[model samples]
Target: MIVTPPSAEEVTGHAASMYDRDTQDDGFVFAHTQVMAINPEAHEAFESLVKAIVASIGIGVYEAATLGAARAIGSAHCLLAHGRKALRAGVLDDDGLRAFAHHDDSGFSESEQAVVRFAERLSADAASMTDADSQALRDVGFTDRQIVDITLAAAARNFFSRALLALDVPVDVVPGVSPKTAAALTARVR
Candidate 1:
């Protein structure tokens, strides 16, 4: 995937508008968004799919699942972006962010740990998963609908993260997280 990402000005239609909005909201467009800008329609459709999934399971869980999947898939870009989003959503503190990679022993609840495994396994091998895999989420109080939504969120993260990595997209610099912290997360993926 040695594709060149389009500049914001190079993008047309809905994607150009989306890039503008991302810039306005975050002060800069993310590399992943810039790459998707080449096909604004597909980018919009993907955003819609992720929006639906996030709305169903809530942002916190969605971000948590994204972190797990991103880590497993070795997408440094996502690990940083979603890790920041998780922090912004009040799901984790600075110290918690530092421990996110080792989520199982990071003092997360059983439910949270389950979400991480679900996301990682789904990213690694979805076909190998059985009903019991989803049942564990239910045992932790996730509804069938929530489980489905979680699966979709993880799948969606994998889709975007893998593409960005394959394209050799660099991670955008997010504030608050030091370069050292970001480098550590990126190193884990390598």
Candidate 2:
């Protein structure tokens, strides 16, 4: 476990923090304590970014992309963390979230499919991204500005969440998905 668990009060992702209670609040706790402890301002900034991202996409699409990216990378910590919260927040259905974990192609809408594809591209091979993928995003109606923001966010999650897991931080964010996907999602390894 954690060599030194950060202060509970400093932790933002607690079980009772309006996200997941029993499931993945530990990450929130770690995130809270780490960033808030260092600079409380970061807390507000992160919150704002989260809100902006959610607002950028309708809930379904955001959750689909987030869950899809998390699962595609098999990041157990991030997967369970975001998956639970996304589902509870009505970002996605349990089935779709779980399907993402299994790398299933079905369950996502055409637009969502495109979004997830973007996330995957950024996650799997950031530097080697092909021009076609960016074009595909444009063809799908994503503006160039939005594409940049999306890429930054996806990369941030991948790097940040992976760091958290590597550091032995407790995960608190549950996968935002339907209960059905929980089984399939949980079955996959990091």
The estimated TM-scores of all candidates read 0.89, 0.72
Model 2: weakest 10-residue lDDT segment is 14-23
Alpha-carbon lDDT, every model: 0.81, 0.61
State each candidate's clash count.
0, 23
Across 56-105, the per-residue lDDT of candidate 1 in tens digits comes to 78887888788889988998888888777877788877677777765442
Question: Against the true structure, candidate 2 has what lDDT?
Answer: 0.61
Q: Candidate 2 regions off by >4 Å?
A: 9-43, 89-91, 171-180
Q: Report the error of model 2 at residue 124, Å.
A: 1.2
lDDT by residue (60-178, candidate 2, tens digit) is: 66665666567656666667666776667765566766666767646667776787888877877778888887787788888776666566567666765566557665543343444
Give the total clashing residue pairs for model 2: 23
Task: For residue 96, give model 2's deviation from the true position in Å.
Answer: 2.4
- In candidate 1, clashing pairs total 0
